[model samples]
Target chain A: MKVELTLFGQLADIAGRTKFQLQDIPDTDTLQKKIHEMYPEMANMSYSIAVNKKTIHENTVFEGDANVALLPPFSGG
Target chain B: MSERKIKNIFSQGPIPATFIAESIQKHSSQTAIGGHSIFLGQVRADETEQGKVKAIDYTAFEEMALEKMHQIREEIFAKYPITCMHVHHSLGQVQAGEICLFVFSSSAHRKAAIDSCNEIVERIKAELPIWGKEIMENDSHQWKVNK
Candidate 1:
């Protein structure tokens, strides 16, 4: 399945762009591994994955097309 | 508890003092509200190794923040006997010493208003999916993490 990934906060800085598309990433676990492989610096950074705007703690499988977000620790007032 | 719609709490740039005043003025018609509590978050010029922060650039995952905020709002209303509540948080850049966040809670008595207002602020700081990039004088930057 194809999915779009949007990075937020410091992750956006590391990626040099905010959004990208990935193919064959069926689950959040594989997505994390692929992301770290692409941006090794992010391996040590702590962040949460949000699928379709909902933050998920456990690995979630994507049925079809999905919108994924890499959210760093929130700092809003 | 009454039925309430999910409201957008974001405003571009700093929240002006006049706007805040107008909000309070509008609420005067609601005589049932005996007390109102307000919380204003200011951008402090924090010192870092790069330089002193001159401003903050705020951004958020809007869809998620609104959804999460709606849940928090509903929970607060159920827990407290508040008459009304208003929240406004700044987007984009806000200079140091300017107001970036405003939360107002009103109730029949002071205790409910004050307590709910304080609790909302804490939850907002910890729960919302927003970020602030500290802009330094020399064009350097750092991300702000709430304590």
Candidate 2:
């Protein structure tokens, strides 16, 4: 399945783009696993996942059309 | 009818005093106890382990931020006899010592207003998906957050 992935903040800067597509991932967990595999640097940073703008924990299923975003810890007032 | 107001969220501009004044005016209750308290958070230039923070560039996951803000408003209203509450946060780049957030709450008595304001601010800091980049004097930057 194909999923749309978005990177924000420092991740966006390091990745050099805000949005990208990941192919061949079967589900959300696998997608996350693939991301960590592709970007080993991400393993050291804390982040959160939002599937179609709603935050979810591990084991959540990802429909192919969902818009997934990777977010770093927020620092706003 | 009472008015409900939502103001613009920005990152590099002044927080309007009207948001606070209007919240007070809207929440006025003749029979309820009367007092209001506000908490304003301002950004300051400071030295960090990485470097000197010259300014902050603020950004938000807007869809999620608004959703969280609405939930917070509802929770505060349900938890306290608050006449009204308002929260405003900035979006772009805020210079050092500039206002970034303004929270206002009004209730029958001073205690509820003060307590509600504090709770709301804490909730916002803890829950919202907003990010800030601390720009250094050397043209480098790092993300800023409360530890």
Candidate 3:
């Protein structure tokens, strides 16, 4: 399965874009695992995952209709 | 309950103190409160760990920030005996020594007002989808948060 990932804040700068796609991830957990595998530098970064703007933790069953975003800690007032 | 008035978010330059003062004036009443407390978060140019912070570039996921602000207002109202509350935060680039956020709360006593002000500011800092870039004099920058 393929999933779209949206990055924000410092992560967006690191990734060099606001949005991208990941293909062939079997599940949410694998998607996360694969992301770390591809970008080992992100291993130490704290970030949150949102499926369609709602934060989710653990394994989320992606149905291909949801938009996933990786959000770093917000520092603005 | 009185009507909700004034803006909770701004995308321009420095936040005017009059906005906060006006909000307090509109809601102040001898019957409703005897004390009011406010917390104003000023942007500082000095970055303790990363050297001098020249300025801060503030940005927000506006849709989410507003939703979170409304939720915070509701929570604060429910948690305290406050008669009124106002929260305004700056958006876009703000230089050091400028106001970033202004929170005001009025209650029957001083303690609750102070406590409410602190809580609201804390929650806003922790949960809101706003980001700040700490720009140094050398042009190097980092996200403005203690990790």
Candidate 4:
């Protein structure tokens, strides 16, 4: 399965792209591990994982064709 | 209660003063609204160790931000007796001294409008999934976190 991944703020700068498709991801837990493997620097930052626009703290099974976003702490005014 | 429709709260670049003026003008006919409270967020230029901050470039998970904002709006309306509320935030680059956020709330009395407006501003800062990159004059940058 494939999922659309979005990187925001500093994460986007580190990842070098805002949006992309990652393949062969079975669940969010595994997808997170793969992301950490690809971007080691991301491990140091505190971020929340959102699958299909809702933040999930626990391991969640990807429903497939979902949009995943790595969001850092909000700073909007 | 019926679900309120989510609004597009984003505007590209800085928010213009004329737009704000027009919004205020549009409310003149609402005689029932005796009080209006407004909050305007302006980008501040701060001197950092690397250089002076020049502007802020904002980004967001648009789908989620709008969803979260709508939830907050619903909660505020349920809690307060405000007549109406409006919230707008800037995306892309906003230069220093330019407006980035506009929150306006109106009510029959002053207290509800003031309190709800304040709460909405705080909620937007803490809850919205928006990110900002502070660009320095010397081309350096850092991620902004609400304090």
lDDT score, candidate 3, position B12: 72
Question: Tens digits of per-residue lDDT for model 3 on B22-141?
Answer: 776776455768888888888787755657887788777677677677778877888999877777888877778888888888898898899999999889888888888888888888
lDDT for B10 in candidate 1 is 99
Whichever of 2 and 3 has more lDDT, that candidate is 2
The deviation in Å at residue B17 for candidate 2 is 5.2
Native-referenced TM-scores of chain A, all candidate models: 0.98, 0.88, 0.85, 0.95
User: Which residue pairs collide, candidate 2?
Assistant: B10-B90, B10-B91, B11-B91, B11-B92, B33-B108, B34-B108, B43-B97
Q: Tell me the tens digit of each residue's lDDT in model 2 across B1-147.
A: 213333334434657667657666766554574887889988888888878887788888887788777777777888888887767888787778777898888888888899999999999888888888889988899888766
> What is the TM-score ranking, best to worst?
1, 4, 2, 3
The prediction achieving the highest TM-score against the true structure is 1
Q: What lDDT does model 4 reach?
A: 0.93
Residues A9-75, model 3: lDDT tens digits = 8887877888888877666788778878877877789988877777787889887655777778978
* TM-score attained by chain A of model 4: 0.95
lDDT of 4 by residue, B27-136 (tens): 99999999999999999998988789999999888889999999999999999999999999999999999999999999999999999999999999999999888999
TM-score on alpha carbons, each prediction: 0.98, 0.87, 0.84, 0.96
Top lDDT hit: 1
Better of 2 and 3 by DockQ: 2
Candidate closer to the true structure by lDDT (higher is better), 2 or 4: 4
For model 4 the TM-score comes to 0.96
lDDT of each: 0.96, 0.80, 0.78, 0.93
DockQ value for model 4: 0.90
For candidate 1, the lDDT comes to: 0.96
